[model samples]
Target chain A: MPELPDPTHETYYSAAVNEALDEELARDPAVVLLGEDIGVYGGAFGVTRGLFQKYGPERLWETPISENSVVGMAVGAATLGLRPVVEIMFMDFIALTLDQILNSAGKLHYMYNGQVTVPMVLRTPGGAKGGYGPSHSQMLTNLLVGIPGIKVVAPATPAAAKALLKSAIRDPNPVVFIENKRLYPRRGPVSGPDFVQPLECAEIAAPGSDLTLIAYSAMVPLALEVKKGFAAEGGADIEVVDLVSLQPLDTDTVFESVRRTGRVLIVEEACRTGGVGAEVAARIAAECLDVLEAPVLRVAAADTPIPSSMDLEKIVLPGIPDIVRGVHELMAW
Target chain B: MEPKPIDLLLDCFRKMLLIRRFEETLSDLFERGALGGTSHFCIGQEACAVGVISAAADTDYIVSNHRGHGHLLARGLDPVRVFGELMGRTIGYCGGRGGSQHMCAMDHSFLGTNGITGGGIPVATGAAFALKYRKESRLVLAFFGDGAANQGTFHESLNIASLWKLPVLYVCENNRYGMSVPVSASTSCLPIAKRAAAYSMRGVTADGMDLLAVRRVAAECIAHVRSGAGPVLLELETYRFCGHSKNDPRVYRSREEEARWAERDCIVLLGKRLREEFGISPDRLESIRTEVDAEVEQAVAEAQAAPSGDDRCALGGVYA
Candidate 1:
């Protein structure tokens, strides 16, 4: 694994997103931010806090509760040589914008014979936290990952969030940048403008020979915690991998790690049935089947609605123990 | 002003004729299994497409719906390329990846036809926002059916366009029926233009059958929108001579209804205006029609002869 470069600054995950938007807005006159309650109210997660005051209403537009139109407007604005970053308050509301996202924005380049590019980022908060109920909390990255066109990036750390978002905004293709609500308050090292992780690659946080534990977004921290506990308690020597870009997946890095470790455990906050973990596991099995000693396993949320209660929510979502258990079981083979 | 110029009238008449002949050709070709997919023909509503599109500047943008062949052609898209797309040829606009409803020519500022009803409204609004943000003089003309006026996106798009005072002309081609349901059945007799008041924007209705009348209203609306007064909702009361698509038998309407709309055909109305008002001889109009037919024939032959788009690299061009 490459040595981790020390970040130049430390800030909250939400602050990192704000910094990325601030940088992009300042850098380009055509870059605009539009969403519901994002202007004076900042944002649902306050990611755009003070941006409206900073950039003013012209660049920072406060829109009505029109999710489909918001996304559609971004798609249109992008075609006209403006980079637009739209926000949907909750990830689940993306369902309302699927026509604009999947059919229009995602297929535009390909369908239009590459005459246009949708240089836009759809930033929305997802994952189970704050007991926001079923409508608000959903790791619906899988819904977008299945799409052929748009890039899907779920940044795990504040540093990654800040960097990937800046990259996503600049990216010519449409990008869906998913943020975890739980990570908003968490503070982490965020680099300056020059430091940005590529939106297409995965990072191996910890190196090990025993097993490869893969996760993204909120699950990455839990996977890292599992790695720390295993090292301290003299369990398996687990390597942690963050599959950042889910669509243009970093399968090469995963295939290399799975080949070395001979075991894999994919984790995700989404449901197990058709979650991104299932895709990662399937890819590993297809490519690393010869080198693998055991079947590729996945630790994902149960195929049920996330309960409102904290106790039920904890059980419904995969935790640190679930990652540790999945790792242990994968190594058992 | 001085008498309407002969050259401009001829151009409008030629555009309407091209659309009418193009749809007529598609109808024959579709019956013989020459074309691949179903197409929505705008046979009688040529005046609406030609009139509004002609009023805009060359740099102005346009968003269209499924029945948008007339709109694209009237905006000066190459008929050969348009036909090539329908024929699934490699040289077609969109590389034949997008057929009739999805054809787009970025250079012409035609944003392509949307498959979903009212899907193009917000996109056109956004384009207008881009123009306004850049302080460009270019405006956007978004064309949809009367069926789309009832969609939530229609209202939401109008609201945003009005709020921002974007340069956009929202045109609703009220062809009376959406697929099978008439506008009267779907909503009240209150015309689609009346809904523009809810967004606090100027709304007007035009005679879709009369080419000169449609152009006059479109000219005024385009001027108002270009001046940044706000977006204008201009509803053109038109009719489609054919079914919603090739497969649609159009059992919903009667022959009497079809004949009534046929009497006020946009092409015939324009032909009378050109001959009676401009005094262009019938021979001259007949020669133009013959020339247009030949042009369409050549386009069809070229599109038919073009190589089939290879799907071996089907996954190519998805990302960039």
Candidate 2:
């Protein structure tokens, strides 16, 4: 029998991001951190606590509340041969800087005929709740996933957060690494606390061939929990695939599982309509429709703003029950 | 501030004239359907753009605005590419992909002039920070309007630029109106440069219409920034010769005020000085004009003839 790795102490998603930033800064001179209040305040979420003390104001910069400007600054900094991990505080704030991210950060490589690459990683906390209703909370992955020239990543665990961010910072292209504000502090084992996972692969945590459960970010943890419960009680077979990177979605792994299982269930914390679930379903249908034995089932939050109440939040968000029911429904077909 | 006999002075004056005429040309063309998309002319406030670039070396960077033809020309960007960009042709700076406002020319260190207001301010600040980190002497100039002065990014960039002691020059072109809204109505301050005190930065006021004053102020700020004293702000009190854009009738301003600024026309003022004070012979001035006019026309012809890119570009840049 082999030994199982223990999950590390959970701190919350912001803490994981801050640890990764600290590790990366100590590890590489080129890696710099920029965001609003990441200085004396240690970030809005306390992820960047004491970074200003360690790295000084030169490496750890705190910019004004200008998403566009901060993003643009990140781009220019990256273009000039520095690696900048820019934090946008909240996902909704991206609306203010879409031009810099969408136009400048996302277009610099192609615009310069591949001569210039802006190696920047934009980190923002997303999801509903946490005292923020509509204005502060939003799942921006839906909008960011559709854009080209940028890699979008959402890590559900501390290990995944640290691993994926390291990879994103090293990659040649710009990356939009989203930290689900709700998933911070949750921890798991990593090959190295400073390890970097491949950004283009979906991690398959459990092995099964009956049906594939595609998920990312916070939804992946929920889907995995449901998969374990489904295997034990429902005796329903399900394969859990964590799409670590959403933009360059590792569709090959997903489709391969779909081909074997002959069914698919996608779980997303984002609203169902235009969510990453829709993207997975459309791609599977368009590319491998014949391989599917049943319709692609999706366990996603309702197409409404995330409610603040814990009870309502559970109902609105994709949870274990919703995912289990989705697996059960697919099994029946 | 007195005008200097520096060659840059005469050269910038002609460039401003060319920009005025070029924008006026675009306005005429836009009216007759010769050019497409929105047009924001730097008609009256050409000196700020012309003068600031005069302080720039080949390596320094600039982040401009939508109304950037004057800066583009002043920075020695070929008119062909500028006009080509407005017309959405491949020969443009960004291959016609970015038209009217978003023009990128790395050769001259003009990173971009974003369509969104206050978008480039942070970027310029970041570039300056990078220079300090890399130990490069290159100074970056971020040019924004009076309206952008109120933006969160404006505050963020200024704050960081001063806090980090980065080599950056913040040039604010206070042309009275941000779009149709007057500065007095949009901002709570009479002189926006007074706000520099908030960040512990040195602030100076320059007659935006006077190229030499703009150049002198910009040079001082650039030196201050390069010496590791951090960023400084220079407010060029200028006025827009045309409306907010080509379509704007500028019903916001009185004809009296418009004519008053017109009398202070930078190009007109510079040309008179070039001929009268510098004793640059009328023939030499005429020769310079003839030479620049021919070059601008050739550039226009070549840019117009340049092929166009498919505006249907589906992918973004800077990523794989």
List the DockQ of the predictions in order. Answer: 0.88, 0.41
lDDT of 1 by residue, B171-285 (tens): 9999999899998999764788898888899999989999899989999999999887999999999999999999888899999999999999989989998889889999999
The top-ranked prediction according to DockQ is 1
Query: Would candidate 1 be rated incorrect, acceptable, medium or high by CAPRI criteria?
Result: high
lDDT score at residue B252, model 2, on the 0-100 scale: 85
Best by lDDT: 1
lDDT of 1 by residue, A122-214 (tens): 999889995877888888977888888999999888888998998998899999999999889889888887666788999897798999999
lDDT of 2 at A326: 84
Per-candidate RMSD, Å: 1.5, 3.7
- Using all chains and alpha carbons, the TM-scores for the candidates as numbered come to 0.98, 0.89
True contacts kept of each: 0.87, 0.57
Q: What is the TM-score of candidate 1?
A: 0.98
CAPRI-wise, candidate 2 is: acceptable
